[model samples]
Target: LNEIADHDDEGAALQWLRRNRRAKLWISPVTLAEVLEGAEDVDAVRAYLSRYGWQGIHRIQAETAARLQRRTKHRLGENDAWQAAVAECMKARVVGHDDAFKRLAAGYEDYRP
Candidate 1:
């Protein structure tokens, strides 16, 4: 999950992790991009995420992107589709609270990440 994904209950994912003691999870490069580049404060975000066992995976390559473009043809947009591609590549779920993303994923098979 990215920063936007955690807006649910003001960081509920982390809270859930802390409570359940779960470890070793999948992550996507798109999510990581948000983590490293789009955060309000990188240090604080990193510190907060340090509590979890975050295993990041790279996104699908360019051909995959182009292939996805040809496949979807649904105007999912670059950023969102990139995120989905990363999730798909990692075989991880795209965890997010964004209504749009949720709606997009509803038509496909995915985890909440």
Candidate 2:
């Protein structure tokens, strides 16, 4: 979400997008909600995000999120846990600038710039 919202085309996230244009990108429901919240142009953001594949949260992801929160002693925020869970369930990497992702034992790609 932050990547798409970032105006810096030279940022790490944008660079990652360019580098892996052929890769199958995905967005979770948690991400969609986060992107929509406080967005100045909801329609524009939604349209841009529509390019990525949507990954819905299921029972497995929910359970995984709960487990992640418990394992982290509730240090992980609810949304972060869900994001990690979705990545885990899909066997995908969590790409973002959030340091909180380091606490979870999931595949992560830090796109900090």
Candidate 3:
């Protein structure tokens, strides 16, 4: 998302997104909020992100995120915990450059380039 917002076409994350355009990707509500919070043009960003699927946080996901946070000693912050929880609950791979995601036991694809 940051890559897209910055228009970093050469970024590995952006490249991966382009390559997987047809894949069943999903975005968490937490992620949507975070992205929009920092976006200079919220409407544009929202419109751009509308193509992906959105999964709302449920009780199980919240519980999972709490457990993950507790187990990690709060290393995975609240927002990231939610993200990880959503991905874990969906059995999906988390694609991001955040090193903190590595601290949790979730499937992760490091897009740090």
Across 1-113, the per-residue lDDT of candidate 1 in tens digits comes to: 35333444446555555554653555545556767776666666666566545544343445555666777546556767676666566555555555545544543433335
Q: Model 1, residue 83: displacement in angstroms? A: 1.6
User: Per-residue alpha-carbon lDDT of model 2 for 1-113, expressed as tens digits?
Assistant: 55456544577777878887887889988888998885777787898998889899999999998887776554778898899989999888888888888765458878654
TM-score of 3: 0.86
Please report how far candidate 1 places residue 68 from its true position, in Å: 2.3
Output the number of the TM-score-best candidate: 3
What are the per-model C-alpha RMSD values against the true structure?
4.8, 1.9, 1.8
How good is model 2 by TM-score? 0.86
lDDT of 1: 0.55
Q: How much RMSD separates candidate 1 from the native structure?
A: 4.8
Clashes of 3: 0
What's the candidate order when arranged by decreasing TM-score? 3, 2, 1
How do these models rank on lDDT, best leading? 3, 2, 1
User: Which parts of model 3 have CA positions greater than 4 angstroms off?
Assistant: none
Q: Against the true structure, what is each candidate's TM-score?
A: 0.55, 0.86, 0.86
